[model samples]
Target chain A: MSRPVSLPRWADLALLPVINVLVAFFVAGLVVLAIGEHPLEATRILLTGALGHGEGIGFTLYYTTNFIFSGLAVAVAFHAGLFNIGGEGQAMLGGIGAGVAALALGSLPGIVALPIAVLSAALFGAAWAAVPGWLQARRGSHVVITTIMFNFIASALLVYLLVDVFRPPTSMEPSSRIFGPGGKLPFIHELIPGLPKTPLNLSFVLALLAAALVYILIYRSRLGYAIRTVGANPTAARYGGISPERITIIAMAISGALAGLMATNEILGVQHRLINDFTGGYGFVGIAVALMGRGHPVGIILSALLFGVLYQGGTELAFDKPKITRDMIVVIQGLVILFAGALEFMFKPALARLIGGRG
Target chain B: MELIDTAIGVFASGLRLAIPLLCACLAGLYSERSGIVDIGLEGKMLAAAFGATVAALSTGSALAGLGVGIVVSVMLGLIHGFASISQRGNQIVSGMAINMLAVGLTALLGNAWFREGGRTPSLEGAARFQPIALPGAEALAGVPVIGPFYKSVVSGHPLPVYLALAAVPMTWFLLYRTRWGLRLRAVGENPAAVDTAGVSVSALRYSAVVMAGVLCGLGGTYLAVAQAAAFLPNMTAGKGFIALAALIFAKWRPVHALGACLLFGLLDAVAIRLQGVSLPGVGQVPVQAIQALPYVITVVLLAGFVGRAIPPKAVGIPYVKER
Candidate 1:
């Protein structure tokens, strides 16, 4: 017979996350020792650098925008049980398309240029991602294999475009010219003072709205029910007249377009001009975000904000402490993923008990 | 009259370029055949390359460098095995962790050691790898039609070329003719079956992954000590991923992997040569397009048109035993 969770409600799910955070601390300390640094000092500096100054807060919010978009993109695929590793390539090319549009159509009004650039990016990214989705749906090809392959092909193509076709004549940076002022996103600081560089442009709000839309689309819509059923059990879903084939295509395309939104936030909102590689592996890092969030939209946002802190704070730590490379951030990032992956072992019992159940 | 001679020279250069791919792909063949993914092959090669360069620079011995490369790889292999097999972690995650570790460690150590740049000191031609031209094959240069072709195509490659060529036969014999090979195959196909038969399933799988490390080590050392006589950061680039694609394209078979490596290598060699060689109507094709040709083809092939490619049945699935 099934049993209800017998533990006190407060001591169940809430306490478990605290313990998990402590474990993350221990793991991060181990890596610090391996790299020959004082973990406490590094952690202290990392925290201070992230929120210590006005600019630090801005950096945090800026990064949170990218994380939110990428996290949702990967989560959509994860909920569909498809591992879409091609996010980086998709987002990168998406940025390129956005950049080209922004640069070419500077004559348009600010409002029109921004939306056009973002939608163009979404369209381009969708077309690029459609190749892998088609492969999986049509030929019994594995997404893992095809996505990995597409990544290399996409990066190479981007590199070629940057060096040859799009190389700006005005600057030596391996990038196109700065998008005209008309294309610039209105910074939060520009509109309001003393906001700690929130960079609170229109796009961050859009991302929050997108998160809600994704939740509604995935959980409330009929399409959402179909996708969830397919993810839970494809065979059963198929037998019930739900088409796994069609859902795979739709879900992957949606995921890719959402990934393109990150380009909009990054290039159109914050950076204003696309560089050679604007992404610091945000697309790939989003996978970890999705996993840690349990594929929940709210959870994805929480995880995204946490990762945004790491990214922003880590960059600040790099400038302040020259001895430490940006790569240490990677070690910490990897450890976070390692623990996140192992969460089932730790959380299963606690979650079970939270509902008055016994294992 | 000299067009044929130029063509012959390019083909010779192409095979030399192909050697490292062959070595990495063959090593990939072993790991994948045993049902373990070797995405870390690039990192393994990179670490081995650094090991070889440091050894050669410090010890003045190529043989010592080769030995160091293999040992370093085995150690890295154990790291992969420790996390993936012992801790029961995900294989892809473990491989990715090692790759990240290799990237940071190689750069950190290289900077500390080099003190000038993130690159080791370059060597003289004396320290560099030399081609092992068979004497009579050199005489084939003077012969009529067949002689020039044989001399240009078959002769004048470095030791690793022959080693890479020989590894195909060695892999074939080890995979089909030996008991250890059978055990490895069993582990790849189903570790539980081997476990039921009273074998240590984890031990066998670990060995297979470790073997991949060894192969990656050799492939890497061949690049730095054998090819360039120096080391640079991220030098192996995405050849490791290319090797993985080749492994899949070959369907985890040794013979097919070798052929796939050669095919990709040839395309790579051709692309590099075709760079800056403009056609009359097209003006010029960017080197990037040519360089991207291999990966583009891999994507297209993965898009389901090139025959059929299926990975091993039990690949990337961790074997958890019944308690």
Candidate 2:
């Protein structure tokens, strides 16, 4: 007779974030009550707004598409043990670079322009992340601090360019005028006459394709092993003759490029132009998703969807429920991060015991 | 009289802005030198700024406000130290958590209490910090070269301006002079060696970080009650982070941090003066680019890839006491 075993350590690891999110939701319900809203009704409203209607689904799909890119960017860096907080800045700069390519070099055919703009965004993001990577790899400077500093610098630089250098001739707002029609991503409105609704365009398909590529690259490639080995233990990798410096820099650059790609999708497919706060805190949220997903590709997709629903649905719930503002959703997000981060404390030992008992 | 007075006013404003930066840099120096990463200086400032505003607004006294700010920041410092230095948590993560929590909680409390997003209502001039006009400046006002600059620069700055200037020297003395300073340097350089001695490593680290918070709090309160006379939402902006850069670029030295801050403050003053003044060829440089100058400079200085700066060895590593 064998003792019944609990989840293997690997499965238990995945459960930690799930448990944390549930606890966070419970705590957040109390907050809803304090805000004078019915917690049950608010939860229902949030779910319905994000996933129930066709329009809600459209919004969720659009958000999930972009979020997947951001999540993968952070996850890639994490796999190399480099905390890349500069994704926000890199994505912003990437978006602008892509926008410039679209606006200035839009005379080219659709297929060429699209590929060029996306590639340019990826390159811009890579270059941005490379600076900090070089600093960390060669100089022994801390990646976390340097990346944070770079993010601020990137944001300020982008703001400087957007306002003064990139202002189009016609628009008075901070944003540039619409990129030439050739540059815009073909919307579902034009692609299919009777789609579920709205401007949730082909970017969604592109995003899913990118995620699939990422999964294969991370799980099956020799390069992925090097990045993971470096992340797990750099000294061990060095002993094994893998240059940690090269892997670290390559990982960061790829991460930045991925984030940049996400930003481009939003600017090209949805908004049609760059504006102040255009990235909409997507970079920061990506960190949360990456952490929540434990840096797994499938987990990242799931977390991105969860975040998209929370974001799109939370806003709708806030608007319908007068006392709740979009800001309330931020509190919930913050709570999720807090609880998610506390995952090490929340699980592990108990799960270990459970596995031990089962064994 | 008019020209001299205007020059003095501009200099005074420059001093006022420069003081907070210097103070925050000093806070950075203390924490970094003691081998603890202190990115929560922004949160400390925000708490101090809010505390100072609330105290000043309630008591109608800027002094009390400054006091409240300092105390609250010290408490926040202890919390940061508890998490990062003692408990072996990730320093960047803890710092970020503190910052986010401060942002959320400050806004949450402010709205709930005052019906605004982290904004304390503006105060009366009398209730706020006012610059002290130095008496000796009048005697030297007529002298050439030194007189205009001196009168313009040093004569009309508020009390915190003087405190910030004094802090550089005070920091130098504290870092170099006492037994405590030696212990601090030891801990920063090699915590194991410091731990071998009689003192508690965690306690020393907590003290250094807490002291930093106090200084940063003073800086924050100076911003609200003294510089602008009100607490504005997210008013700390990136100043605290910039101060951290200045701390590093200055090689974590007190005197150097002061010099770096003054240079930045001077650039800011000159830019403001050049507001309407067009260059002979290039028309007025846009305000947005001018605003980005400090951040742009920060990146350039940090990329000093010439030879990378090394932080304290024990910095950001939590020390655990073993039996």
Candidate 3:
């Protein structure tokens, strides 16, 4: 066997991730085939369903809005070398936060109520994540375990609040009352008249603005430099007078804040009320997005779009192909995580050999 | 007499619930002790439960179901081993992938094959693990506290319950009184030292991982075949993580793992009984608060409130050979 070699930077950044995604798709196709479905036909249907018409595109982009928030959340934590699996819990708490604010201030003007809801979402999410961060920083507890545990705790807490506290007297369902007119986010179609009516809302613009800000925060700022330094080497960072503990907590807070924004798209924009499990596994999907995007903002946007396509397409596929369920996308997501995140270096040595790099 | 019977019933139910946790916790103990962190235990158990249910439904043999469950779980464990051990990948990421994969595959396949919304047909008669009554259990039921305790708690459980009970002592003996156990512990603590002594670190870790798979398979199979008659989607329901918390609470010791799992099981049983029941001065205890207790206690314990739960020294670090 030949010794492993490094690829050129551009190829490392672009070509490798594409290969991983293609391999993931290939395995997904095989799974479809195993279920006695025609893979090519399924792919055609999926692609067409996700991108065929104006409404499909609108729905896809709406889903993309949520993914961008969550992917950015995971990426920010990755920059600080913290695996924040608590994104699911944080996002759930964020929904609760947004719901609280919207319910309380719904009679107020839209301009005043919406921002408060968004801010509350961020604060609740940050607080939810900060405890685990503080535990890891101060008490030597592993954040991964703590975050995983927090996800379950958050689920139970959500059920309790929804069933016992938030449910309306007339309703049998475990959900809060719908938000007032001021609390509702305007659909993008309302703003731009030519577009189809979909859940795509002002939150889409917020997601883009968030992506741009995250780009600046991770690359162009001094704190970004400190975060990256601490992630790369804690000992050297400490020698340079930067506190690793503080950076860990800060990065986690920022990550949690980004994750919290997902609630804006789901709760305020679409649901218009606090529903049980409104996040709908997008937080876990964010791990796949962050890994596939290689923790870059631009890459995250692109990968988020891809997942959105898969999700919208999978829903359509379920309608067309009775045997193929929506859960097929989860298999694809797992494969992407496997190939892109865990076995990321599996194809590296072979790729280097082909690209003619010197060891 | 009525109160005693209710207490006996609750204790018996607690013991039954503890069986799955006991198996998974012991499984985690082996893997973590050998320096591999397995967050995928939940996924493996879910897959095993699915496999066991499907196989038992078809073959009408509970033993065959157990066999298939173990095979399926072991295959997943090997995949984890290949990624973390041979490929030198991130163990946590690999475990997460395994978990997601199991969840998706089980649901998708179960739906495709059975068409019952991601569930197999219920097991019955020969397809399920029937409870076995001990000799003279009925005859001794007329006696006092000792007879009721012995008959209800000790007897009338399925074969797997006894097997699970026996596993605790077996694991203790294997881990403490054996040379292979010493080498396995050494590999987890210091792989370089084990490698310098000419033992294959990867080989020992793989064995430990396989052992974990076998144990999880038993727990999962028992869940479907004895405790429940059908395989439900997402049936493991975070018990894997609870077992993991119990493992930490036990501080990775075999005997302590048994105690911790039973305690958790008792908490679960009590929570179920207390639901909607108004106590003196407490007015209707919230079931959700009781349900969340295990996770909250774990977080507090992990934060060093109940002393430090130190993991294996080299745990979660992939060993790389220096060139």
Candidate 4:
């Protein structure tokens, strides 16, 4: 089979994604117009609401932190030619791990309790992910289907644990008791007293560090080389003495570990307790983040920020224009995913031909 | 005799639940058998449910609603085909996109039109599918154990349930005993060979996908107009995914898919019944465990712990004709 001519570096890396984003926004604008709202005004309101003030910016950053963890989780797996759609389930299990750690170590200082929670989160996430990874690597079961099924199982498991096992006697709510004060991570506002109060916490810094580590691991390390090799051509990797199965398992484990950290941000940093559906589609949103970012650490960060804008800004848009609900934001996100992920190559061939003509 | 009666009642409900699942399972079967992996079955069902419900509300005709629902699902199927087949895009990504789009679009439109919080106005009597008594059901009910079984399990189901039952045999025949079915199966296994055989690979795939959409639409219509009176946000829940799992469990065979859907439906019925009941050896079986059974079983099956699952060789890979 013949392959289409590849686009130039500039078009592939920069121009195409920008064009896709524009198309997404254009479609979103049409929806807004259809609802009898001014598209330009809505865009202005969204930008201002998401980034205009310190509090909005802080909230944006806070959402971005969760996306980074889940995005990196997906990127790592994608590098091994694995689609780990189980981030939702992995993250849910991770919260239980963090919750257990916090409740057990609540009497200790935040410094002491925080590291334990983080450790448990990663451990739990990796373990949960490893099941499907092992199945895919050893038994040839498709990881995509397994991971998707795992998400539903994870939700049921979380509800069982929260309602049946972990809920405090006094509370009727389906959630565990609030963690002790020492287990709480300090919010950014506490560190910078002049800043506005937001859920933004030390986790943002942790996310940035994780992104850098992912960059080094994926682009700089020998393991990354092995992963890329397996993703690109497993037969060649097998010939080169690398076991594709082992790499698949290891890559998914790391991906799950990254996804697990999202629980730390929400449980330890924000919610202060284990709650149902606290992940709030963030894990699924990570798919869009990873796809739009092209699975690179830097790209993931940028796309994560873009989605943060959509989320925070969309909330404001819905509030300002009652006719347009928050679900419209999901529609816009879907459009972006469609253009950047599914229809990613739709425009490439045409663009290539145009570029060829220009030369 | 009393225990036997209760067993029949539970089995009846299981059959009722299996109707929607059978529709979706057949839908996924057609798509996958034609080399297109359709994870967006849930999305198509949701969109169809919303479309059907809204159309019924406006026109006051359940039949009209069913028609509109099929159109919407077919449109979604076309989008999936365009992205995965023509554009050579990632099939999974395309499916996810459709799912997300449906969730948002349905909610947005439902909220706007109904002003009832992302749900349609409930239909009364004739606006929805009412139970239809089979001919001589009353006469059959007086004939002992077999009578009650037929009365409870076969008679008085809405029209869609009967349609779903009829569809299984129709699907079986169409897939196994027809020339088009042969071409469809051949394309999924090796599109290049089909292309070499002078058949249009893309045309066959498109038709299979559209047929899948039509089946999903009927399933969605059943959910909204027959099982329930109105459309609610994400009313399909994970039934579409469960249907996909069923298709996989059945190894892409139409007849086996019917059995798989009924088995899942049975599991669901039992889970609902077992929620608070305490078993002899086990204390009240946790609701979560029963609810998680299907997924757990699917995973185990996929792991080759039970039966083997081998997808069509060319499934998920877009066909490209050699120059």
* Interface root-mean-square deviation, each candidate: 3.8, 4.6, 1.4, 1.0
- Winner on TM-score between 2 and 3 is 3
Ranking of predictions according to DockQ = 4, 3, 1, 2
What is candidate 3's lDDT per residue for B288-321, written digit by digit as tens?
8888888888888899998778999989999886
B219-292 per-residue lDDT for model 4 (tens digits): 99999998989999989989998998888899999999999999989888988888779999988888889788
lDDT of 1 by residue, A73-122 (tens): 88888777787877888898788888889998867888888778878888
Error of 2 at A78 (Å): 1.2
Model 3 captures what fraction of native contacts?
Answer: 0.69
TM-score of each: 0.87, 0.89, 0.98, 0.98
How far in Å is the alpha carbon of B168 misplaced in model 3?
1.0
The sequence of per-residue lDDT tens digits that candidate 2 reaches over residues A1-359 is: 12333566656676666777787778778877875678899889999999998888888878887788888998999899888888888888888878888887677777888778878888888899888898788766777767777777677677767777778767677887777776788877679777676658877887788788888878899998999999999999999989999999999999988988876678878777776677777887787788788888788889999888988898798578755655555566556665665233445456667767787
lDDT against the true structure, each candidate: 0.75, 0.77, 0.91, 0.90
Error of 4 at B210 (Å): 0.5
User: What digit string (tens of lDDT, one per residue) describes model 1 on residues B135-211?
Assistant: 78867767865677777678766666777788888888888999988888888888888899999877887878777
Instruction: Give candidate 2 regions above 4 Å deviation.
Output: A1-12, A22-45, A107-109, A189-199, A320-324, A346-359, B1-10, B116-118, B125-127, B137-152, B281-308, B320-323
Question: Candidate 1 — which residues are off by over 4 angstroms?
Answer: A1-31, A34-36, A163-174, A194-201, A342-359, B86-88, B112-117, B123-158, B190-200, B320-323
For model 3 the local lDDT of residue A132 reads 90
Give the poorly placed runs of model 3, Cα more than 4 Å off. Answer: A1-4, A357-359
Alpha-carbon RMSD to native, per candidate:
4.3, 4.1, 1.5, 1.4
| Predicted complexes: DockQ each | 0.33, 0.24, 0.72, 0.79
TM-score, candidate number 3:
0.98
